[model samples]
Each structure stands twice: as structure tokens, then as C-alpha cells.
Target: MSGTQPTVTLSGGGADDARTVVRALEGTFGAPDERPGDGNATVHTATFAGETDGSAADGGGEGAGRLSAPVTVTVQGSPEAVRRASETLARVFTARDDGAASGDQEQERELHLMP
Candidate 1:
């Protein structure tokens, strides 16, 4: 909603893993609207400000590192946004395309990122 970047929701991983994943996306989507917090909760969410021009930002890629456990991430936004997020995550993590559901103008995809 901020621009064109998808709002990503992540569950089933530790706090470190969540931040790492967010950091990876930051490299492509710029900083998130609000940074991911430290937590043991089942889910963590990050919303990108979507102000950047999709140029490579900073924080991850090539050294993003893998998660200690599997992480299930959901990306919701326009079709283009969903596709870009999915592609970025797949490149940064060991990801499995669990599935995707589409809405009128929004698309949601679920992926599993493994260590």
C-alpha cells in the first residue's frame, strides 16, 4: 500500500531468521516501514515503505545466510509485487514454493525457507 512493495508476513522461524529474511528483502525493496522486532512468537511481519525505485539497497544477498529452521513466509500485494518478492526470497534463501492464491488485484504466496 505504501507504494508497490508487498507486505511480508513470516511465521514458523526464530527471531534471527525473521530478521535475516527481512534484511534480504531490504536489499531489493529498501528499508521496511517498521523494522522487525525480536520475538519468540509464531509470526513476524514487515512492511516495506515502498519508496525506493527497486534499485539494490543494502543488508543482504550473497551473505544473507540460511535460517536455522524452516520459515513459512506469506507475501501479499499486486501480482508484480508478489512475483518480485517470491523471486527475491527464493534467491536469498532455500525456499520451497508451497503455493499461491490470487485475489482481484492482490496475490498471496506461501513459501518455506529451509536452513
Candidate 2:
């Protein structure tokens, strides 16, 4: 079996959301049995890839807008466990339109899984 840990990229509406997701992941997969390095699993660094605001033509508001960033969350654990954790994260973070669609303010975030 492969002995390498998987890498997952989560797109968040902002840095705050990214931080929340990272914390959520640690809580989900960093349990005593999984994360021995709290003495068990290693908490890799979390990175934010910056945010971009679309122009008026593309669908941005007059001035400021909701921020978005690419968040990379890394944890060391069994491959099976990591994959399961990532899938669960995807489901939890899926975007939902509350009422911003009409204003052309919908934000799209995607999660990428890497082996």
C-alpha cells in the first residue's frame, strides 16, 4: 500500500472560513487515535493563497466584496482515513446560495484532492 499522505485543497470565501475549515479538519481527523502527534498526527502548515474580487463586468459590487482564498490543509495519517476526511469536508463546505445570486454576488469555491 502507498505510504504517502494525501493533500487536499479547500477553497473558502475568506481567510476566516479557511481557518475554520482547518480547525474543523483537525477536530475531525486529529483525534487521539488518528493524531498521535498532538503526540500522533502532524498538523502541517495552513496556507492562504490570497483573494480576488471580480470586476463589475464579471460580478462584483461597487467597492468591497466577500473575500476568497485557496486553503491547503495537510495532516499525516492513514491514506484511507485522509480520503474519508477530505470527502466529508467537501460535503460540509459546499456552497449554498442564500440570496446573493440575484445580485450577481454568488461565490464559487472548489476543493481539489491530490494523491
Candidate 3:
């Protein structure tokens, strides 16, 4: 699950749920290269050119996401990006860290998101 850019892959829920979580991350990581789910796909992925300083959002966005069901999010990137992404998502949604795997330079973390 390593990538050049920090990538967020969302699954285990409706497309809307994926969009919701992705949008939440956007507040911290900026817009992604592609759009999120479109309604038919249960799984969606977005890759972001993460901030240079790796700063996170303060959660001053619009209304909170309305998830139809629980979603599983996998974040893959450098260790800093992965950790920042996990913290940003946890701030927006009810998140439970599933686990993590690491390599020399990249890492991946799985989280369960509920709303």
C-alpha cells in the first residue's frame, strides 16, 4: 500500500460514506488528484499531494459527515504522512486503529471509521 503520494483508500461502506471520509481528510491534506466514489462503487481511492510541512487541519470545516455505515480507511505514505492522516481522520470521525505495517521508508495504517 505504499505510494509516491499519500493515498487514502476507503472501503466497507457505501460510496457516500467514502466521499464523506475523503472530504474530511481533504481539509488537512488538500484536494486529491481524483474524485472519490460516485455511488456505485463500494470502494474508493484518492491520492493527495500532501502538505510540505505535514501540518494537519484544525477541524473548522462545514457540517460533519453523515456516514450511512462504518467505513474502513487505509492510509499509505511516509510515516509522517500516515500518522498525520490517521490523526486528522480520528479528529473528524469515530476511528479505531485496526493495525499498521511498515517498511524502510513507507508505512500503512488501517482504521475503522464510524459516525
Candidate 4:
């Protein structure tokens, strides 16, 4: 999927905060979603799923422990857009983890990427 439009799913601990995080990240990218706050309250996520791959291998289907519907963030620029988007989401999770840690919470928030 080289040179193809890349998407980053910005999931969070809840619905409202997920949108906030997306907005924050999108604002950082300077291109917010057309319909912001569209994501619904998942078990605990705001999954922004977008990509050119239309297959089962992408893992975009209903399965156990899967929360919320996918929020497709269309990429229309250079590859750097994808990288920036992914980085924005990554920072959000990191901040969340830091917050939880500050509260003496030991929740695990891991972002595993497999190529």
C-alpha cells in the first residue's frame, strides 16, 4: 500500500473524549473531519479506520472485544499526512497513559503495529 492514502484510527477511553482527541489531533493537522463529533460511544474507543484496502485481512469487521464503528479519515495529500495523523493519535494515547499514571492507575495502554 505504498503511496496510497493512509488513515489513522484515533481511539480513546470513551466517546466524547475520543472526538475531543480527534479534534485536537485534526486541528494539529489543520484539517478536521467534515462532520466532527460523529463518532458514537463504543465500549471505549473512537476508531478512525481508513485505508485503500477493502479486504478481510485489514481486520475491519465485527469480532470479539471490538468497540465502536470505524471513523474513516480520508487522506488526500502526501504520505506525510498519514505520518502526521498517526503521530497525533499516538500522542493522545501517551497523554492518556500519563494521566492515568499520575492518578496511581495501572491500566495498560499499548499500541501494537504489525507489518
In terms of lDDT, the poorest run of 10 residues in model 4 is 97-106
Distance from true position, residue 6, model 1, in Å? 0.6
Model 4, position 15, has a per-residue lDDT of 55
| Per-residue lDDT of model 4, residues 5-99, tens digit only | 23334443445444544454433333333323545644333223333233422222212132243332322233444444444444433322222
Which residue segments of model 3 deviate by more than 4 Å?
1-4, 52-56, 60-64
* Candidate lDDT values, in order: 0.80, 0.35, 0.78, 0.35
For all the candidates, what are their Cα RMSDs to the real structure? 2.4, 16.9, 3.2, 14.6
Model 2: which residue pairs collide?
A: 35-40, 35-41, 36-39, 36-40, 36-41, 37-40, 37-41
TM-score for each candidate, following the candidate numbering: 0.87, 0.33, 0.84, 0.35
Off by over 4 Å in 4: 1-6, 10-12, 35-78, 95-115
Name the better of 1 and 4 by TM-score.
1
Error of 4 at 110 (Å): 10
> Considering TM-score, where higher is better, how would the candidates rank from best to worst?
1, 3, 4, 2
> Candidate 1 clash total?
0
